[model samples]
Target: MSAAAPPVSSRLFSLFCLASYLLSLSYGSTFLLSLLIGSRGGNELDAGSVISAAMLSTFAAVIVSGHLSDLLGAARSIALFSLLLVVASLGFALTPGFGNLLLFFGLMLGLGWGVFYTLGPIIVASLVTPAQRAKYFALLSGSMMTGIGSGPLLGRAASALGYPVTAAFYLAALASLIGALLFWRLDVQLKKTPSASASVARISWHATARVLSSRAVFPIIMVGLGGCVFGGLSSFQTSYAASRSLDYSLFFFGFMGAAISSRMLIAGFVVKRDPLRASCLLSGLMMVSILMFGFVVDDGFSYVLAAMMLGVGYGLTYSVINGLAANEAPSGTTSQSLLLFSLSYFVGVFGFPLLAGRIIVEHGMVTLLLTVLTIALLNWLITVGRLIWRHVSRIKTLQQA
Candidate 1:
């Protein structure tokens, strides 16, 4: 057998966490892009279309960047993407009008986020041992969630302080520039460590297809559904809150607070105990939370509660499902599995917003909520089905013996 991989140094891991925070902070702030579009005389459909176009670009970028990371190295790929993010953010801040140019900026944003998120776990996975993966992933996720959560609050603060909401884009640009520099430094640091495994070999297309078609399908589908719920909620949040005359910050605070807390405190334990069962339970909570948000949330208290419920449900479920994807990856296809997992999620997170935006414009927020609720239900059913399938498979093995 080959020599064991070197353990990731605490300093290196800390740096990774910081960079992740900055990158996601940039992304999270852009959650206000809908508001930005509104300021530019665009409506929900325009915002959704722009954002959806970005997601499509992200879809393409994830595929390209995953291969590029394997070929060029993760740090370099991330740094390059960070620079793109900086450009995109600045474009949003400096550019005038809401037209096709916004779509171009959206593409740039998608490409940047696509690479940063996809390569992040791959880098972490390589550095840590299998035993350390869950804990480290959870910690990394917390940093990311914290940044994402902080972005909106920063915007709210900016607006309250008499700054234009578009100022958030400028701040996002600065964060991306700083993150790029740190990642560049990381690349130099890794180059000095002769034993560092900074990149993986590229797998064949056929091998990739096989892995995606296998047990990886479960996590892919679940994460995609989760993405749909998240995209629908976040992308249209400004409009949704307006319809009810509620403050949108509550949703951000409640969702991010609960998500970050659960990932840090309880995610590893829940995943360890029984991932499938945990997924089923959490997804059910997600459905209920959506229902509450749709039907019951009229005031701040109820809205915050629903947001928190959705946070815990979707947040923990994401962690658990991610673990399942990694665990169920066949043989040497771990990287491919993770890449596909990210892609599937991008489809839901980015793709659904386009449809959801139209739904809100034409049908109404209630219809949109019902659609997302159905997705959550489908996600829960899949987890339950997977659990039953596993039990049946075990029983068949026992009978054969």
Candidate 2:
């Protein structure tokens, strides 16, 4: 006899809660790291490089975890990774020195995050019917936005309360532990990996190669480009606000709030209708928002308005792309398709920031935002062009028939 699995709704609710909590922990930790690193004799470039390294590590881990999750099962893999998340958070909170920060907080924490992120979607796709994917993913995105929105405020409150940095980190660590325990409690197993020899499982080159050649690559590229826009914002917004004497916490709050609202209210409608069109529209809006940031420096209200636009654009784009990538997964290769999707975003997150760091350090955030705006426009054009080409081909085929 086996234990009964929890209802899909319950399991989804648990996952959603976990996603929210973990994202909060992540955003708060990043904010703390920027301040801590700067106070300890590092600069903006150092912080950017550190964040880039973390995202790069996540990219690597996601590639490997996809195969591992398929082999060990998503629930089991999530439970295992959640423990790493807990340990890493505690280590980050307790350890001192730059080397330790890079090791525990950057690399170790990233590995855990990569696994959790990849497996969460896999499990969600398995649990729900296809029709429900867009809606549920929107909810999941909303939950993440909620976390992102609150994380900065949590940090600000802790700072205002004169809490020791150590205490603040401890709270984040506790949240990770709770998330781990929740994942451990899930009883769902919607699909099992095909049995294979240990050696075959060890070498996943075949799976990687197959996914690279599949149709999912288009969405993967699109998502990666979209990530470049948000990655720049995430890595620099706080620093940018600080440089301008603006309240970063309030601005981030506005950004995340708009993001959550957009995902909850608009993501499903857009994604369900046509992913490519949504991608183009959202990408264009992101471009406009980034451009707006350049001019809104003096006015706090304008700054907040720009942040809201950025939030809504990024929030909607993120979930829409994820759902599209998941739906594009081929038979027996869902995990691999998802790997490509995750890998692309992290690539953008890592590469964009790392490249923009030099510009930020040299010229200014104004120059960086303009550069990012160009990239965003290119991404939008590419996606829209593809959609137009696809439509043209379909019409030609119909005429021939």
For model 2, residues 80-113, the per-residue Cα lDDT tens digits are: 7766666665675666655545644667666777
Could you give candidate 1's per-residue lDDT for residues 1-401 as a string of tens digits? 12466766789878988988888877787678778888888877887887787777877776787578767788988998889889888887787878888788889988998888888877777766665666777777778877877777777888889999888888888988999989988987766654555565354688678787788779988999999998889878878888999988898999988988787678768757777888899999999999998889999999999989988998777777776777688877777777878888888987898899889889998999999989888988998898899999999999999
Could you tell me which 10 consecutive residues in candidate 2 have the lowest summed lDDT?
193-202
Which candidate wins on lDDT? Answer: 1
Clashes of 2: 0
Model 1, stretches more than 4 Å misplaced? 1-7, 191-198, 201-203
Error of 2 at 60 (Å): 4.3
Q: lDDT for every model?
A: 0.82, 0.68
The C-alpha TM-scores of every prediction are 0.94, 0.87
